[model samples]
Target: MPVSRVASRFAGIEESPTYAILDLAAELRARGESILDLNGGEPDFDTPGHITAGGTQALGGGFTHYTPSRGLPALLEAIGDKLLKDNGLSVDPARQVIVTPSAKHALFLSVMTLLGPGDELLIPTPSWVSYPAMARLAGAEPVFAPLSTDNGFRLTRENLEERLTPRTRALLINNPNNPTGNVLTATEAEAVAEVARAHDLFVITDEIYEKVRFRGEHLSIAALPGMADRTLTVNGFSKGYAMTGWRLGYVAAPEDVSAQMLKVQQHTVGCAGSFVQRGGISALTGPQEPVEEMRAAYEARRDLLVEGLSGIPGFVCPSPDAALYAFCDIGGTRFADPAAFTTWLLREAKVAVTPGFAFGPGGERHVRLAFATDPKTLGEAVDRIKTAMERL
Candidate 1:
């Protein structure tokens, strides 16, 4: 027998459950079976034309070398302008921001730079699958504060306070959250801000889905009173601009933290792709008409998916006000175990979804279906789901 050589950091972290679903779907595909995939968080749209052109232009114009690790000057300036205009934040582009390969990278950088052994990072679940994994990788304890399913998984100050301990150093938030598509209302954002204030906790908020909003204004916690200095804001062009393959995102943090993350960037990947950074600038500052149009399409798809799911027997789905997923409760169904239900959907319904336990505590009896596909495909998925339920 070979010696087990995996390090302790890899102990509790299994492969990402989201990716595991993708892997399973791939296996079914390999066997030549039809699979209706509703598991990915990626947008189903093309990158806006101007943004692609911007990247091509940069490449053709000989901007293919390593950029400053912090990012190109123009892109940083555009990001700064965006924060001031859209998020009510004013930041110095040079000292406060670092562009990375993706929002996931920005998160990894933030986690690695800010956390260490014995420190606690507060995560409110049902959270994105990566939050706890990132905390664990940083050698920090991930304390999950599960939001109540009774209240539509809404964020409340009490859930966070209940999980607080002396070792707690930070809170990570994702607005217009993935898996559950719940956008934080003004009151909820304030609840987070208040908790952060009372405990002196730094906040690392992921706003990747900010522009995909379908309801009230998306608020940035950093824009709240007394939060500016203690918040690290991460945003990217993946969801909104449909540039997932571009692998680009940026983090706006306190200057010192930005410096430390920059060091991590220098050692790992050096800089983001030169051309992608240029495209990011265009995505931020170019024509926003495509953004508006795509959002309208997503809004329509959300309505369709929600209505369809609501019609299914024993399925309870709240219309997500923003983002690309429909988080549904299957607790009332005959196949009440989310893991078992997920398998049944794949085997019988030929429909694939992520089990809710993949997200965290309160999501146990649910499953998340991404609505990023075309309306026809989404409709078929819903029909398949209903048929599967009827036979059960």
Candidate 2:
């Protein structure tokens, strides 16, 4: 058999380092190594009981059929209602929402619908690993707008303007950001919205961590005046509801964009699972107790992880106000490349973390540690990391 040529669109895309490291650590653990995995972005807690019961009811009711391409009207309505209640934004269920298999799928569909060859996307650096790859898959160029550690890795209006160009079609914003745990302030979001308005660029906002915010409120860039018409908001049940395995997510956009995305989705995933959509409805409409419980637990874990890492020599740990990860810089210490450092840590410290460089340039000296684990395990991982650094 001859080897077939791989597609050029996927030529430079790399696997997600967080999941990749978790897999490697799991394999080692199978061989009897005690690995403390901080590389995974999933909550250690189980899915809420009410949400699980809803899925059970859905299964018992035989909801195993395909839904509309945009999603079930009930789920869409619940999503819209949830958005308005939680984020102070109104969305029309019939035209503004499309439920996807995951937030990743929603992003892919958005890129496919909005971009074409030669179109450009301005992606903030130290971003989630999938953003650039999704842009590339859509045959669009991804221009990096680097975020500084001094600014909590949040994108400012100045940074957005510096990266804008005539070919730029969209700007991606991840608030309560993955890897960095940075949430864009309302002031910063307004600035970014201004630039997008000036350039007539589509704004793609990933608010997957919206419900997981620990500090102040999670503000949507689309909530700013005039941004609602131009923003595509991507969110999911994975991070906030502990429904990662459910693989359900959604995008709310302008009617035109949602219509186009529905077409793209129909050709690709068709629709998300009907029963899962029911579960999602329960998630949005059910009690707020579980959400608050998870938030409280994660807040405690975040404090523990941040405090522990602070004591480690040569470690510069920034306090993340939201989300589940702590992104720490390990440069000027024993580690040179973050990937190599992660490998060494796994082998020596028996701890696994995602290499920061996998996120993009400017992330080379850092690593992402997910504090979604219990405090006992997280404390041990920090101790092991400190011991390993001392040895180096």
Top candidate on TM-score is 1
lDDT of model 2 at position 282:
93
Reference-based TM-score, model 1: 0.98
Worst 10 residues of 1 by lDDT: 16-25
Predicted candidate 1 versus true structure: per-residue lDDT over 186-283, tens digit per residue: 99999999999999999999999999989878999999999988899999999888999999999999888888889988998899999999999999
**RMSD of every prediction:** 1.2, 1.8
Model 1 CA deviation exceeding 4 Å by range: 1-3
Clashing pairs in 1: 101-247
